[model samples]
Target: MKDKVKGLVVGVLLGSLLTGATAFAGTNTKISVVMENVKMMFNGVHKSTTQSIVYNGNLYVPAKTAAQTMGESFTYDGKTKTASFGAKTGTFKYLDEVSYARIDGKTNRLYFKNWTNPEGLKFTIAGQKYLHGIGVILDEPYSYDDQTISIDYNLNGGYKKLTANIGIDDYTRNSTNSGSLIVKGDGVELYRKDDMKGGDMPESINVDVTGVLKLKIVFEATLDNGRQIDIVLGDAKLIK
Candidate 1:
């Protein structure tokens, strides 16, 4: 009886191994995988010539190709892991084992902490928080403080016009401060504003830069009295 039981167990094990081998052999058949091509269009025009790919159930497209489709210049630095557009730049870093790209520049709407002022006295963003993405806040702890904030851009003879939206932060309900917003090219002032109060609507400014080299958007502020004041360049952009 023992020998018969041992024989049945061995036979069962052999049958299972044979079945697995047959399944493995069936998988050896050649199967074609079809990849779908993606088209990226801007203004009703096709942008990509290279096909996008799907990996791990995620669609992946070439960064450079995608940017080119939208008529924006794109460059990558492998050594520094940095990517740059015409006048904008961003860095790629790993955080929590996940990679992220952070762009360094100002846009139409910006948070106080995200504003970049390379040419100005050291300042901080302080005071009651407002939840609108309209402009930048300068100098925290509202007191008598003077500072300048600026945004720099490189034209390379592409854009012909530049526009800026200037205003005082709406959150500063009641404060006393004076400031000026100035646009300069090649160290020459093109436009300046010295009169703006808190809770005031932003003003639109336009300038011709057909033959200028470097463009700078500057905001200068001085504490008049009462509490520290805030000024903002609500929006700035170039147009062809």
Candidate 2:
């Protein structure tokens, strides 16, 4: 039965390509394409459901199928007519993609960085370099108390989880200073680390953010010998 259904689909595709049928977007514009039943594979395993199709000499596959096969999640919004492929199966938003409600930092503001060449946030943790992150660093060292950098993200009680890698940037690896990372949901502390040193591998944070109206991420620099701290929130994202 499955084979019969597959054959029917292929037959239709072939007929449309040969007759220069209109594309699937409901437009009247006629387009010529070539369809093929190429084998699909992912990570050395055969993927039967994700059959390959050739269009304009380019190989295309089902978006949702391919996303799921790559260990990611796919979601579609009918009202907004939007689709998303993200870290979680449902709707997902990266932390850097959103605006910060407030950032009470002693010096620099929060900034987003990617892992691309020439321009990106580069950090090394336990000898592994990460390519994506949101980072902030202090300009001056203060001895009065721990230089606190508090950043607030307004979730508005929409997302269920917040995941990230918290650590110190590799640029400050030579420094003996340390800092701390704290996660708070709706003014309640969810996670905390007292001492995060440079070169130490980043710590994974996956905490429940359900019903969290205001999420606060606090970074405290334990100033030592008048040195600065570079804290990075790597790959921070919200999952719905």
Question: What C-alpha lDDT values do all the predictions have?
Answer: 0.49, 0.68
Residues 1-240, candidate 2, lDDT per residue (tens digit)?
A: 222223222211221323232355346665655554555455567655634556665666555665555555666666886656654245678888888898885533455764333356475555556555677664345443337778898889999998888887777776677888889998789988887888887788898999999999888877645687778888788889
* Model 2 misplaced stretches (Cα beyond 4 Å): 1-88, 107-109, 114-131, 139-146
TM-score of 2: 0.60
Clash counts per candidate, in order, are 3, 0
lDDT of 1 by residue, 95-170 (tens): 1122112212333323332234443222222322322212444444643332555655565555566654567754
- What lDDT score is found at residue 76 in candidate 1? 62
Would you estimate the TM-scores of all the predictions? 0.42, 0.60
